[model samples]
Target: MPARERNHPLRLLTGALASSRPWTFLRSSQIGHRIRHSLSAKLAVAITLAALVLLLVFGIIVASQLRSSMFETRKDAILADASLRFSSAQSVFSSSTATSPDQVQESARGALASLKASAAGAGATNVALLRSEGSTASLRINQIEDEQMRGLITPQMREAVAQGGAQWQSVGIRASDSDKVSPGILVGTQVQLPRAGTHELYILYSLAADQRQVDVVLRVLVLSALPIIVTLPIGVFALLHRLLLPVRLTVSAATKAAEGDLDVRVEVHGADEMAALGRAFNAMTSSLQDTISRYDELAKLQQRFVSDVSHELRTPLTTIRMAEDIVWDNREDLPAHARRSAELLHDQTERMEQMLADLLEISRYDAASALLDAEERDLRPIVTRVVEACAELAQRQGVPVEVVAPARAAAEIDERRIERVIRNLVVNAIEHADGTRVTITVATSATDVACRVRDRGVGMTQEVADHVFDRFYRADTARARTTGGTGLGLAIATEDVAIHGGRLQAYGEPGKGASFLMTLPKHAGDEIASWPLALWEDE
Candidate 1:
């Protein structure tokens, strides 16, 4: 497709979809990560849940209190009405106009009916009159308007009413027309009739009206709470976002500062604590920027001094080399002591030249002027060459050196730098071998190649190992003398590997052994995921 044609909106959209197809999982994970990490979301959810719990508790208490109050008020009204009707019915039963058993029975039934009629509008009510023991059988009245409610008068209620006091019990009321039941109250008392006998009178009142009223109130409350429940969290979230805006800005500024943008500053708006925090953070970043600027200047000056000194010493060193060579060549004509002095002077001059070269190299690294001459080459030959070069030193130290490698191990690297690194590691191993064996292993993975040098000798402690690659650092100064080293070999090696984006690590334990592992990628800029050989293998 032409570039302009591919730039069309529809085409671009399609291309975007195609490109993003494989990243759907990544996008979902990112969303989940955001939700899990977002402070506002977490706080909002917590506050919402807490508010819901509190509202639930409050609704329960209100509903319970209303229900109790309704029941108590209904009970008082029922008791008052029952007492009035009971007194009127007793007067009717004791009337002199009805003397016979038939008349007494007739009067008893009429009195019960009158009581029911009098209490009609109060609420849904059931009336029952039953003869108790000691009543004349012929004159006994057993009357009940609702059969279901008559059974609700329990034996306990009847006995309590028979003991001369009115008794009421809460009960369930089932309608005759349906299977549904509602709550009710049953009141029972003894009623004495002239020429007849004592009878139990019971009145049952339905509380469905009170229940309906309570339901309406609960519904209102629930409806009222719904909006609050919905809006409270939103309000809280808005407040939190507003309150935390300064903190968010501060965090963003701190993040930029951490990423080396020390000029980044938080904006201060008010005289509150958040504003104070912003001011403090700005002051800290400014101080850090100044400190870093000063340190950078000092580092540049140090590098320049080292470079100048190395270059300045080179001229004098060259003159000394030329003069010493002439003396060394004619030392045979002098006395034995003079000959010995000439040899020592020549050796010292050579050592000085080597030290100066190392210093110049270090300066290049410090100035970041070092270049990589990387090429595709086999590493087996490189390791073998380094081992062969260290053979004389290994023999003198009474240490046996061995090379373990495959036939071919390849990587893209600066062969010169790699050779120098391997040579230093081998020489260091030989000097510290303490009459033990020094082994070099070369191995390769799909992406990387590695070389490891192991010496079973007087190993270093953790503290010494940590400083092994620092310039002029020596585990023991006596060891450097034995090998005539400048003490910058490992430091240079470290820089070499770092420039190639590879790793060089040293491991050691006191009196055990020391190992140095160098791992490099096969392709430039490729990351090395795994090493081919273990740096420290358990014995």
Candidate 2:
């Protein structure tokens, strides 16, 4: 055989083995991993495997049943023919005339020979006969020869004779002097004759021709089934893949959209589940894009509004501050009530100007239109300066201010912004300290620098703490009066810290005061890699 033909069966078996190995391990590993990571791939693989398994099982069961039925029918026909021949031979011999034993044997031989000749012409082989009483046997034709005829009296034949009944059996016979053995059917019957006593009549029929017919049938079955079995899966897989192709595309587009590619879309095809999915995904993306566009437009409009308001108020604020300074210089010449009112007006005007400035800063941050000129600087000095600026106010409010610095810590930030953030935090702390001392602690680590402003005043509740950084949000309406805050202080400070790629967090509990910690990156243009401040620390 050629190499290709020789390896054909091995190749088929190997392919089957290879296909099964993945299935064995897939259920526990690959399938689970695919399901967790890729839903569409998982579904496609699952459907294809299920269809193939069903086809394979159904094909095997059908082929096995067909083969079994064909083999059974062939065996039954062979037995039926042997039974008819035995019955006919028995009738013919029972009605024969009186004769010598030799003549009787010769007539019987002749009759069997005629039947053998007819069967041989019809493509049968190894026809023979065996006597029951003695070792006498006869071949139906000389074509059978001596070696092929001698082995007719087998154990199965002897048992059939001993049992004294018509019997049928399949046996192997040596057809020639060669080593090859052929399979045959044997029929045995008991015969009784006058003065001849009893003898066994046997007929041997070779199954070579029948086996050749069976082989042809098997070849046909395989030829027809092989194409169907192989092509059916291919056809089904192709149809399924085509049907699901749109769904796969839609899924891919959705993934891209999730990854911030809003322009991705699937081409709409026939009305199917896949097409419906594509349409739905397209609709969702369109809505999301529209919403985002509108948000951008509104943000621009808000930035313009904040800019206009800040510019318009700055001129009036400058004039008011200058006018207040002039009045304050001559406050002793006025009456008691006028002096008090003038001081109040000056304080209120300054507070209003600060409020407007914080609002503009917060609005700019929200619009993402603010730029920072960042540089590496020490955080320890900034904390100390903020503390010094708040010191006089702290004393007037009867609140002691303390500073703690473990080491000189550096961070990459906009110096002006960082200083403003610290100043706002310190002033807010002093205003809310309620006669209790406030502590400013600066700390450092290899990757980050941190400053924490902690106060021992009446603290905020959880609900209030959650929204403490929200613009214009107040923990207590009554408390805001004493604090004299514009409510944009924390919000502005948070935005400034964020612009420097830093984080600001607040920790507080009712009646236990509050702590505000700012953490920033230690290296310029690098992300914050460590948090220096612990959540829980001893005072």
Candidate 3:
């Protein structure tokens, strides 16, 4: 087989998979499809994102303000305490009587001890005093012991103190170079003593207590914000789903009614608009059912009348045909013009007889009263008999009847009905051949048989082929109705083939030719699985 013909479905599948559109990804992935299209998922995502952003913004603002306020309060109290102790000790240094460096150091130590005693429970951890003598700096007082901690003084703070104001810096608490650390602040000031000259006074304030208080505030903020953010979307989804339940039910009921179950109805609840819609649907279906019932009754009555009238006319028509035959036989002894009239009268009467027979046959089909009588037989003899019967008509039309079959083809069939079906097709093909040759071909399969009739003139169009099986329909309605074709030969032939569980099909093209195919099961109980011959002779 060619690649295009063998892999057509695979090519189509590959094309679908190679799409780059967003919907392709969403619809192809099971979880992504749900997440992309589900209203609940969209709602949850939107709510969670908005809530988190707001909470984070508020949390940052509060944390920043609370930390700033806490540090400012600690700085104020630390500077106040340092200022008061330095002012009190300034008097002791100013009243000193010694003028030597050793005496100045001893006086400074005495003043520092006095300040430390006066500042008990004031939250200051330690104090340092450094004096500048000429170009060298001397530590006159030192309460903290780490060498690195003694160097914590910055030049900016010293400059601020020298300009006659106090200065402070946030500092970490470290007692030794390798010791544990804690939080604190440093406040320093410049003080002038009588013998020691200008000196720097520093105070360290511990901030561990303030840090613990801020931690408690943060914990409370988290506890208050998390629950509202998480449960809000779930609550909204549950409420919306409950509100849409009735809409889903109404859609389901409408789907069933559209699929041909007119009895389906929706349940009404309360005096809402949905209830009114359900009531209106029920009323429409009830009215429609009543109208359909009336149509069915009228159709059955029409079929009954046709059957009765056909039967009633059969006896009277037989009597008239007998009387006409007697006159037709004596027409040779009459005048020329009278004999010609007799011939036309006889032909018209025969055409009426054929029409009545076709009407009775169609009535039996509409009433579904026809049955098949099957027996095992050879088709060669039956074919020979039909061909011999149609020889006169074929000769009159100047169209040769050609047959192609094996010497012996056997099958189980209703002989009389099958012969009638084949005879109708042969006669129809002869009438349309227009002096061209007609061919009848019979072929046998393991479980089925097929007969084909082909004419080389007056082919059919698509519109005519589609509705050719309708009763009383003619392909060429504008043609003169001169021939005795009652327009019912092929109609009865189709119903007769249907009675024996066979198919009758017609195929044609406008200017080429036409073909009629009849396929049947070989045995009475065997199903027709496939045809033995091709649909078109070109194959």
Candidate 4:
């Protein structure tokens, strides 16, 4: 493939990359939207999560402490009740001195049975009695035997019996034919009698009632915590929903303002950041709308100025051209000075006509009325033709005219305007050549064609090059007078090349020759691919 075709894809890729780059900053409306939607939701979720964590921690501490205190209170009450029963039994038994051994034993048994019945009514279970020698036979208990009482009595019960009457102890007991055990306080006392030496009386009070109370407290805790946990999320959602409405409204108003509704303003009700944002947005929109209105008015005035100048110049130019035509017709009958004067008037009138034509062309381009008549043709032939046309003037000034055409140079372009560009470059080169060599070079690639015109002339400085394409601009005022050339040539050429989506560049240095290059696309409406002409070279 040719160099231009190879570079075409690269140029296209570069353009695409440039266009697809992300903007450096977000627009105001976009920023507002993000803050409105994301910030509010995030804040709400954060608060809800924090509240749940705090509630969970407090609930756990309260439930644990409540359970512990309730259990402790129940334990203390059970111990007190056991102590009372033991003390009463000891007092009753000790006060009876007339009772026989068997009768005393029967009476003690009856007292134990009654205590058991009362404990059962109070939700206690597994109430029992044990003797001090670890024997149930001595007491003649009928309800439960010594084996059953073994687990209920401990070494503490024996110590209480030895110490004195009316002392108490607590133990866990397992009953016969039962897999479960119940915790209880054991009340033991010593009984002194005449025939019987000393007997130990035991009373057991189970802790089942306290265990049931703890269960009730736990149930209440669960029932109470359920409603609080359920309501927490709902409350957070409601609060967030209320706060977020203003933010949503502010965003909607901002969107309308961005879409050119300058009159759109937000209703700011509260002293908050959202309200402040709404006020700022409204002010910005109002300012932008005023600026745009002023710019439109200025643009209309500029258009009117251009239109008035065009209308004002046409009638005078027409009258001047007709007057020149009459003078040319009678030139042969006039004196020598008169003839020379008429010729000068004709030339100057023609130059004026060309200048006016250039102005009209520029105005058309400015108004976007210059349409392209594009086609595919080799640019080498066009450059060659333009140079040949200027050959006579080059010869008259003793300047060498050189043409360098590549093997193939083709492009899609408006032939007439592109031809005008070539003619202008060649003419400008001859006028500034200062009796030196002028070279026109043409080259082609797959996607573009380029032409360069170089002249060893009275070259321009940087200052002149900067405004070289400005209308009526000249490098030297005296040099412009000698050439008798209309100054709009280069400017019109620049405009023509731009209309073809091409570039026209001038490169020069003081006392050095100048080179003008034109780069055009290979396809009409396509971008330039390869700039075949370099700006500077060693040679």
Candidate 5:
């Protein structure tokens, strides 16, 4: 599908919102150390938006106060101006000395006329009077002709007027002649007539002008706040961009260093703490590079010395071996002490020769000159031969060595290298076996071939098992060298097996003995992700 056809912003956004988008953020949080959002990005956005929200709220509050102030001011002015007019009306009705009911009715009519002449307009509204004390308890108003509106003076308004003070209320008022509704206020006061007792005079005013004035002020405030609200985020974006430059550069430098570019350094731009941090990071990388270089140089020198010494000693070692053999042959012709010395010389010479061979092999591996001549071969005969070769050593060490193999276990490998690995495993086990039984098990799986050498001797601890293949690393160092152990046999075997693209592993428990397992791929180029056999057997 075309990209345009595949993605619609609205479509994608709607689908995500309706389903998993919100939860995706939470899912990122659940994977600790892996956050979907950058901290600075999250903080910058949140703070900028928060500032906008606060500004909006402040504008709203200001608009509300302005509205309230306008309404109260208009209310006070209207009430005060209208109160003066109502005062005359109240005096005309309440202070009249008329005793006859007809005269009282006439006085009420005159007072109503005086109120209309004084205060009532489009800005202000109806003025009504309630007859609270007469045989005829009807309501009357000056401007409004509708009797329904004349009766609009509620019981609550009458009660308020009875309290002897003017009070106001906001209410909905509909003109009896028109269906138009308006917001209005009713100010009610108590007045007493000589013939009519406890009458209420209420002046109603519409709040349309007050409402208009408040709306104008609110619109102005909203308009004024808009520029500031918009400009704040841009300012935040600019500030964050400027402040985070060094952090971004530091991250980039760290990334390069992690990828093994030790020379990568962040540019220092300021004398601030961030610049100091960059300098410290550069110093750390420089120290690491120097340390690695020193170790590498030491390793090269060590391998070169081992290679040169082993090569130069081979000729003298061969001559010494020949001399020791001649001495062994003439041992019976010498004194008993001389005969024993010849035997010891032969044994030490043989041991030194084996050590030289192991050292030469180790140097070859370090120099990257060792290569595998892998070919498909059966492993059963190899295991059998190795067990046979180590049989004399096993017997001398008072250990019984056993071999378990199938008819054939075929794999593509360097047969000699595998044979040497088997021999090393067998010999190493015999040395550490301590008169216990040693077992060599050769097994084949569909994908690989494995050989395991096990001994029920003084078993090594787990810590020893981890570094047992390191050069000259012996779990029982004191006895190992005395027992003709070169210490590099396992290390050399490990390196040889790795060249065949196989794995050699050691597993042990303290006092339970150790097992060395070597596994090889059936085909040379095939790699192993998991072992074909368990690293350790079940107790």
Candidate 6:
């Protein structure tokens, strides 16, 4: 396969590794989210990153100090060796027996050869003898052993050598045979010959050994650091997992407790802070469980008392209703004041009986005994009947009610409860409508049906709208109970709809109007996906 199109596993892996960055991975949303949510991941990443930074800084400092110290020590050794060689070479030229240029050249060549041979054992790479500039002698000798070594000694080194003491410079030593260059030091000094005048002697020493040593130390540091950097996250993650085990258990216990498992408790082992937290959590749940138990008992007692009272009052109410009917029938034969009093008494007695019936129904709901006797039935008849039943109130309040429903609006619902719910909605609308027309819009979809009772009346504010369905919550507290409302109509309607797996919502804007929308599944046991009618009517 062609290399570019090979798709080799190792190539793919290397490409990914080369392109990936630690910060990029850390900043990724998935990883960031996990780290933010998970205590273990957060601690692991933090500790590992800190270790990596400390290791890198420590390694850089050690390598820099080690390389600098090695170079300085090698420079000193080069200077000392070159000085000893310079002394020996100078002595050889001073005792030379040369008279002509040819003889001086020969002596210079011999001294250079000897110096090269002696310094070769001390890591010297090249040596040179050059006549000083402006030298006036009968014979002047300028000899360089290697051409490449000439340029290695800078002009600055030459000038420093001319001032009378030994001078050295760090440089690169190019090989005589190849282009390879190694780190080196050049030491130069002035020398005098028998026939030749002043001359400069230079020695170049290769630092390849010292360079190799430093390279070795660097490789060791990098290799050791690689394992440490790779293992830090894994080790920290494992340690965090072990350390956070108690927290995990506590979280699990808390979740179960939130899900109504009041008996759930964290398992405590060691006498640590985590153990203390577990103890505190267990105590809180126990107290909450006890408090809920007491509340449940009180609620049960209240329901039973209400249920018993409602049952007990039915007998007396039935007796009073019989006597009230007889008096009402005979009111036309009595005085005008007596007849008015009889009418008022009859109205009050009827209101009390209705309130008692509502209380019994509420008791059933509170005790969780409410049942739905659902049947597939057309809802238009129910809506029409509710409108007809509340026709008197709507007429009395001067609020005209309009029912806009399809001829065949059908749903699975208990006829009695649904009728009661519709009745309550109609009555409530007429009462609060402020003499404006009340509209009952019934719409249906494939899965759900809805009814909206919209009234252009004295609209409630948002706060009133929110709690309009709460039992005994009157928006106008000082208003007389002229409508004979028990104040549980909306609340009972809400419960009725909820029992059928439906929803009832209220929408209102002060001074505009109020709307109550009831949505239900068309088929029994089906979920309501969407409403057929909008909650707010379009202006």
Which number leads on TM-score?
Answer: 1
Give the alpha carbon lDDT tens digit for every residue of 331-434 in model 3: 99989999998898899888888788888878888888877788887676777788899999899889999998874557778888789888888887888888
Query: For each candidate, what is the lDDT?
Result: 0.80, 0.70, 0.72, 0.68, 0.73, 0.82
- Residue 396 CA displacement from its true place in model 2, Å: 7.3
Tens-digit per-residue lDDT, 29-121, candidate 2:
865775667544555556767766775676456545544564356446655665666667667667767477566766677657766765554
Q: Candidate 4's residue-wise lDDT over 379-478, tens digit each?
A: 8778778778877877878888888885788777888899999998888888788888888888877777888888887788878888999977887876
Candidate 5 per-residue lDDT, tens place, 1-539, comes to: 00011111111111111232211234444443432345455555678678766865775566556655665576677678767766777667667887777777777777766775567553656666665533253333233234544555666655555655677766666656898455566677767666456666677777765555555665665567668766765677678767878888888889999999989887887899889988998899999889989999999999899999999999999999888889999999989999989989988898898899999999989999998788899998888788777767777889988777854779999988899998888888887778888888877777888889998888888899889999888776456433566779889899988988889999887777889999998888578644656767755
TM-score of predicted structure 3: 0.57
lDDT of 1: 0.80
Q: How do the residues 25-126 of candidate 6 rate in per-residue lDDT, one tens digit apiece? A: 437788789889999999998998898779767866776677667766776677778888999999998999888888888888888889988998778877
Model 6, residue 504: distance off in Å is: 0.7
Off by over 4 Å in 2: 1-51, 78-291, 363-375, 391-404, 426-439, 454-468, 475-481, 507-515, 535-539
Worst 10 residues of 5 by lDDT: 1-10
What's the candidate order when arranged by decreasing TM-score?
1, 6, 5, 2, 3, 4
lDDT of 4: 0.68
Q: Which ten-residue region of model 4 has the weakest summed lDDT?
A: 1-10
State which candidate, 2 or 5, has the greater TM-score: 5
For every model shown, what is its TM-score relative to the native structure?
Answer: 0.86, 0.64, 0.57, 0.48, 0.74, 0.81
User: On a 0 to 100 scale, what is the lDDT of residue 375 in model 1?
Assistant: 96
The worst-scoring run of ten residues by lDDT in candidate 2 lies at 1-10
Q: Extract clashing residue pairs from model 1.
A: none
Report lDDT (Cα) of residue 177, candidate 5.
83
Supply every candidate's count of residue pairs whose N, Cα or C atoms clash at under 3 angstroms: 0, 1, 0, 0, 1, 0
Q: Output the worst ten-in-a-row residue range by lDDT, candidate 1.
A: 1-10
For candidate 6, the per-residue lDDT at 362 reads: 89
RMSD list, candidates in order: 14.7, 9.4, 15.4, 19.4, 11.0, 8.7
